[model samples]
Target: MAKSNNNNRNMSVEEAGKKGGEKVSEKYNQEHFEEIGQKGGEKTSEKYNQKHFEDIGQKGGETTSQKKDKEFYQEIGKKGGETTSEKHGEEFYEDIGQKGGNRSRGGRSNR
Candidate 1:
């Protein structure tokens, strides 16, 4: 128990929570977190429909976009693009471009 003040013998709620969280972290590994996250996501999905998710997503996106500037978006976009390029290589973009071209030309690909 971590004491918040020198005068008090009791631990603060924040300090107790931190101590518990540290203990839990020491006991659990990455797989435990992933398993719990998957279960939680499944339960959330069962409780919420597509519309609920879409609405929340839209609200979150709107709020985030309002808070962030063009430069911030550009920086994140560049980082995401770099990560994707590294993961998928240049051929991934070529394949997507081909698919887009095919769709634009009424499923008739030039290639």
Candidate 2:
């Protein structure tokens, strides 16, 4: 158990982690975290291949899907759609729709 100086009560692993993370965040800027994350990602990419990533992604997706209900997925999908709509204009959707239509009919070659 971890103890915080502020209180006599024992801190949980989660609470200690949150406190540590907050302290680190206060000390560092966004770029510092971004650089660390990039280096970690590069190291992970060097260690694992496409198939390993695909396997983990599939497993994670399966676990998440099992834990979440249809309404949860619908809510997330709606939120994502709203965010995308805000970022893109009508022309963007038109172009994507055209590309999708062409792909479905095999009118254009795959990228």
Candidate 3:
């Protein structure tokens, strides 16, 4: 018989696994983690509305522009465009362009 971790006590593999699993569950319950994540997301959403989100995004873009040159953005944009084009057909771009043209035809009046 093999000696277990507990002094000179002997334990089976099944018993050891069961004991470790129970200890892990007691230490970190899955539900508790999910509850915290939901609460944080709710708080963030409450603070950052649509317009505020746009402003924050613009500021981040400005900072990134200062840090990186045009080539960096162009390369990233090329990769993103390639990925999107692969995922979506050409018609998707055409449809969105038509919608954008329609929306912009009247300038801010349409907005």
Which one wins on TM-score?
Answer: 1
Report the lDDT tens digits of candidate 2 across residue range 1-111: 988787688999999999999999999999999999999999999999999999999999999999999999999999999999999999999889989888898887545
Candidates' RMSD to native = 2.7, 3.4, 9.9
Better of 2 and 3 by TM-score: 2
TM-score of each: 0.83, 0.80, 0.48
Superior by lDDT: candidate 1 or candidate 2? 2
> In candidate 1, what are the lDDT values of residues 1-111, reduced to their tens digit?
676565778897887898789999999999999999999999999999999999999999999999999999999999999899889977889899999989999999677
Clashing pairs in 3: none
* Candidate 1 wrongly placed segments (more than 4 Å): 1-8
lDDT of each: 0.92, 0.94, 0.86
Candidate 3 lDDT over 1-111, as tens digits, reads 456778879878888788888987799889988988999999999988889889999999999989999899899999999999999997999878878887778543332
TM-score of 1: 0.83
Report the alpha-carbon TM-score of model 3 versus the true structure: 0.48
Candidate 2, which segments miss by more than 4 Å at Cα?
A: 1-15, 108-111
Backbone clash total, candidate 1:
0
